[model samples]
Target: MYIIFIGTGWFSYVFSLVNLDIYFSKNHWDRYTNFAELSLHILCAIGIYIGRFLRFNSWSLVTQPKHFLSILPGELIGKFPLVVIVLTIAIIAGLYALCKPLVAKSSLYRE
Candidate 1:
């Protein structure tokens, strides 16, 4: 877990900036990208909750597809999953909002 979610999340933002630099120009800073990012983060939080609590890693989907899918529905629709996913998204978003300006001002960032 420590190795997986080590950073406070500046790393992911920086990686996205690099991806934009590669695909589009460095000047491409779309506001809608934030919405897309938030949506992705929410989904990822749900997945993380599933993986952590249910012990269903990525390989479980491929190796044990039937069991994984069968159990997924039950695991997903409940108060625990909802609370965990929401809290994870909230923390990451809050940290992003608090630290983004600092990230943007760093030498690693570009206009």
Candidate 2:
């Protein structure tokens, strides 16, 4: 139980950053891209929580779409989910901010 929970948390955090890094490299910075990335992070965070707490897998979502959709609103409306989602976003944003400087520095060095 401990390992599964902790692993889910760590994997979600790193995967979000990797998604951002991939987008940053592929797409030039733009307002729309920024918004898209943020939304993606939020959704991923929420999905991670659902997977961790509800014990649902990707296949579960596909196999039981109605069941999956039904639970999402209940989860989203509650305080616990809201707090977890917000914290996840904040963590991802902070990580991006910290890494941005390093990426910029390295880009300069590459030139």
For residues 1-111, write the lDDT of model 2, one tens digit per residue: 999997667555555555565666677655465676688768877877888877789898789999988987786788887888889878866776665556545533232
- Give each model a TM-score: 0.73, 0.62
Off by over 4 Å in 2: 1-29, 103-111
Pairs clashing in candidate 2? none
RMSD of 2: 5.3
Q: Identify the candidate with maximal lDDT.
A: 1
Poorest 10 consecutive residues by lDDT, candidate 1: 17-26
Best by TM-score: 1
Error of model 1, residue 93, in angstroms: 0.9
